[model samples]
Target: MATGDNLTTTAYIQHHLQNLTFGLHPENGWSFATSAEQATEMGFWAIHVDTMAWSIGLGILFLWVFRMAAKTATTGVPSGLQNFVEMMVEFVDNSVRETFHGKSKLIAPLSLTIFCWIFLMNLMDLVPVDFLPMLAQKIGALFGADPSHVYFKVVPTTDVNATLGMSLSVFALIIFYSIREKGFSGFVAELTLHPFNASNPFVQALLIPVNFLLEAVTLLAKPVSLALRLFGNLYAGELIFILIAMVGLWQLPLHFAWATFHILIITLQAFIFMMLTIVYLSMASEKH
Candidate 1:
């Protein structure tokens, strides 16, 4: 945690968790943050350079692997990469088929992409928590930046913003499909009606407001839960790794033990995110 220095426990944790932030400063104009305090003060307009870089790079890696497999396909027995790709595709396709009630060409591919992309991001957690950040620090020193100013969080899912961005995109899809399957009026009715129905016209009108309030909260909760679930799990895992790293020689066994267990967590979180997306979209497509 000290990175071979005398950093206090809280400072060590804060340093590892911080993202390399870039944005405008009221005093310095546009510049990368030199401290966590400065980054927080930069407000909503600031960008996490490392989170964006790692996420986009991993995304491209996902596309390249799949593209290569598709291009190198054969009717004969498949190579290792082709076989792995086929199994992943088949797994996602089957998951979608079993869960999604409505027809959509987009769902299977979307599920596959979500599963693979998020899994890749979570997989970064298995890397030694301090490894990349230390490397990032050394690199920064070469560029005349202070080691303390160099922050790099390898796992994007640990950042709430990254997770929320993904969940909100899924939420947008849910809204899009709901309006597409049900007309605008049907969509509005779906939100405003049901869960509280009445034969009396006056009572039904009164129930509309209550129903809308409940349904709106339920609708908004989908993305909020989705984002928090992934972020919380990975962030906790990362924090533990940082704690374990502070132990001198014992870190080796402890780290591997945790990493072995973490494999399942990473895979399950990815599957859960993808599965929930399918379920939400399927619900959106329903006529009720």
Candidate 2:
């Protein structure tokens, strides 16, 4: 075991990285997983409770703060919160204007929500990694639960499922608008036609399978790439934070230095996710 913490380096790292999962256990039936091994046993049906709770909580917070800002907004030299909210709104509005050429009013609000919600979620990583988890462990202790079994990961974006859920949502919108803009035949043709069309109908027929294979991979990659990119970046960042915490006395300085640089990574990732969603939807909405 390491000095201050009773866990070894490997155990400490694992503890910080694991999510508080809840699902149906074969023997225990429906219950919360107290450990990563138990979580794995809980299987495909298991949900990351911490991820869902934090993501939803931050989403509601974003909405509430923005709503309050909107309510308290004034034309006469607006307050600080209103100014900040307006600035964020303008930032997203401009990003959408530049990137999305689509006609739908949904893009602007959606972009704003995506940017703010994701930024807020990523923002959780800036908190000391052990802080919330330790708090959770203490809370568990009060309930007669072992501290060793309490797992809680604060940053939602670090979880692949959270990122994948958001990306799959954008993917659904992409498909919906693609079909709406180009019709069912046009959508099917997009997958089966062009990108390698032939003048002869017979040759074009042969190209359909190849074209569909290529296009299907391309279509699927949108969500897969979006999810992995966000997950990979944040997961690496979280891992580094966990590693740094193992350094004992010198963790604070290193944490600050890394966090200072990480702020850019966090904001950039959210912006990239937002921009990609807009661009993918824009491509879908276009009458090509």
Candidate 3:
């Protein structure tokens, strides 16, 4: 079966990977891309409209669903949605309780949000890859844009920017928690004196810079690793789906097989992201 755009296999995969971008056009001022070359040139200045749209939309949807579940929760017999929500809540609460040493009213809720929001974003990969983009093409036609140029990638977690944005947010929380739990002086001391101790004044002074550099790298690695791990996994999964689609009708069986196994990968990645976040925050909240 031919794709809606009737692109060759390579072009189809490239098109699927392209984000629906909007950016400053030299000729058109702020405008959406009318060509892949233009979108590529937009580069760092361009915003991935599709990724942002789906990410924010899914986040809102997650909050709304949980809010509704909480609002309608009953003491007696719980409905299926309520039961599912409670199960997720209890799971996140237990995970945080087990991992987080310090008390914060925010950890459990944060964990819940991370798990659900990321899982929902990752869930987009399981959609038939061409369906949403095909819809986007139709929408582009209404705007008098060339339908073939209207690229839309629906999986937010597959985008590095989205992953890094979330990781950076977690990094900010870690910093805030570190400052709140340890005073400014203590936090600075940890950076300069940790993982190395010297009794002599001159030796301690000499080690401060070394310790700071090492610790800074370690601290920075958290967000970098978190971002890359999630992005790599989901992006690879999405790429596999796109590749499988290139095989024409033979893609159906492979698609089903890969997607079935990918469900585990998706859930595990979400859980790992949530758990690492909790652990990192817990470490920050500690005095040592």
**Which consecutive 10 residues in model 2 have the weakest lDDT in total?**
1-10
State the displacement of the C-alpha of residue 271, model 1, in Å, after optimal TM-score superposition: 0.5
Tens-digit lDDT track of model 1 for 1-288: 546577888888988899999998878878889998899889987999999999999999999999999999998999999999999999999999998978899999999999999999999999988888989999999999988888899999999999999999999999999999998999899999878989899999999999999999999999999999999999999999999988889999999999999999999999999999999999999887
Candidate 3 lDDT, 97-195, residue by residue in tens: 999978799989999999999999999999989889988888889989898888899999999999999999999999999999998888899899988
Total clashing pairs in model 1: 0
User: How many clashing residue pairs are found in candidate 2?
Assistant: 0
lDDT of each: 0.94, 0.92, 0.92
How would you encode candidate 2's per-residue C-alpha lDDT over 1-288 as one tens digit per residue? Answer: 232356778888887889999999888989989778889999898999999999999999999999999998988998899999999999989988997876888989999999999999999999988888888888988999888888899999999999999999999999999999999999999999958999899999999999999999999999999999999999999999988877878998999999999999999999999999999999998977
On TM-score, the stronger of 2 and 3 is: 2
| lDDT of model number 3 | 0.92
Off by over 4 Å in 2: 1-5
Best by lDDT: 1
